[model samples]
Target: MDKVFLVAVGIGILSRIIMLNTDQRQYPAQPNILLSQLVLAFVASSLGALLVPALRDRAYTSITFLSLAAEQFRQVRENRRDSLQNLEDIQLVKRGEAFIEEIARTYEIRNYMCIITSLSTIGLYYLIIEELKIAKNTSLMISSIIGLALTLILKKLLKRESIGDIADVEIVKISFVDECIMKVGDLKGITNIGLKSDRERYLSRGIGIEIIPKDKDYTNAGILFDSGQRQTIVYNLYSRLGLYREHDEPAFVPLPRRNPKKESLIIAFIPMEKDEQKIIEAVKSCPVLASAKGKNLSLENYKIGKKGSV
Candidate 1:
């Protein structure tokens, strides 16, 4: 029983710690924040692994501790939201409030997921070796390996979905209007742009893109170009292609504006470093939210997009 708890908790904590830096999901990488998360992961995993054994010994009172942990985990979501909301003020391509809430909620659920994973693996190990009367050492090694493999597999299968899965991305052209905004391609409002110098920079390096949503099972068309998803496209694009921006006069903004009448999306961004294929690749790599991923486009109303479809 002692060895089972130790190995299970140990493996669980180790799994979480290994993923701490890598599992940021666009969050900032502050050491203190990471440390706090690690501490939380440890507690959650410990409680989960311990609960099984504690029950065998008839320690029913230990279950109460879970209620306390649940409260703490709820606070984690609140803290994360407050932190990101504070940062949202300064970001040029901001993650909107909806996106922040979703991310925080995801983080909270992730901690619980770790707890469940640890508990399941260790509990199964206990059942095999002790309850089922398997060889102790052999069960230990085999169960540990299976636990680790399952952990990895779970992580792999639950990865974030990317934009390419739900939408079609393509290179397109839409010229700037008034040097401040492009109102072309059936765009509703002014496509806010920059000064002449800005145009020069954009002319030299910018790549125009068009995003089209495919039709099959869409409930709402607007989700295809939601503000949060647009922000995601901008984030991924900037990370890969970089950009030049001023307070109001910037080089690139990867916002996908709806051409409702024409039924298309237009994106005009000036890469800090000019590369057409890379920009296309970056757009493809944008993370698609669960809220946006499952819904399909309406097939009857729209045609599959083509070159300059708008």
Candidate 2:
């Protein structure tokens, strides 16, 4: 039981480490935040590792601690949401509420994942050793392999769709209207650049992109219409490429605007590095948030035609 407990805890922690993605766009980038998450993983794993042994010994009271752990995980989610919300004001481009909510929820889900991994590992090991009467060495090896496989499978299942899956992104020429108003592709009146210096900077450094929805039924267009979704895309661009503007330069801020008539999204921004391919790559890499999914309007087969409607 002790060996099984140790193996379960180790595999559980390993599973969490695999899932703990750290990148430029990843939240909880601070060292303290990362350390807190690791500690939580340890606690969750310990509880999970104890679950099987407690059950075998009929210590039903000990299993109640999982509920307490769940409450703590909920508190962690709230804390993450609060932290992100507080930091929004300082960000050049806000992550938007939907994105923040998703991040918080993901953190909670990951902790649950750690618990699940540990529990599964111990359960499998117990089954192999006690029920099947398998050799101890072989049982350990099989349980370890299966646990790792389960972790990878869960990770793949949790993968979210990216923006490129829903839309076609292309670099468009940045033009000017009245020599001051910015025009990205056919998108006009993006914003007025009254200062000649700002205008010149835009003319030289500006990058434009038109995101055309791939769905013929306009489902992707509906997703693009969401203000939070649009903000997320702009944030991705700014975060990945690095914004060019100073703290006071509101003019350089990127605003992703929708063309309702065309059912497309467009944006014009100046980055620290003027690489067109990189900008396109950034936007394409933006995740299609689960909360932003548009309801399928193409359910014509399910819809009963009105008496006078076509």
Among the numbered candidates, top TM-score falls to 2
- TM-scores, in order shown? 0.81, 0.91
Over the full model, what C-alpha lDDT does candidate 2 score relative to the true structure? 0.83
Residue 107: error of model 1 in Å? 1.3
All candidates' lDDT scores? Answer: 0.69, 0.83
Model 1 scores worst on lDDT over the 10 consecutive residues at 301-310
Tens-digit lDDT string for candidate 2 (152-252) = 99888877777888888888888788979889888899888889999888889988899987743356777777788898899888887888888899888
- For candidate 2, the TM-score is 0.91
* RMSD of candidates 1 onward, in order: 4.3, 3.5
Predicted candidate 1 versus true structure: per-residue lDDT over 155-175, tens digit per residue: 777667666665677776555
Query: Can you tell me which runs of candidate 2 are displaced by over 4 Å?
Result: 22-28, 215-217, 296-310
Clashing pairs in 1: 180-193, 181-191, 215-297, 216-297, 218-296
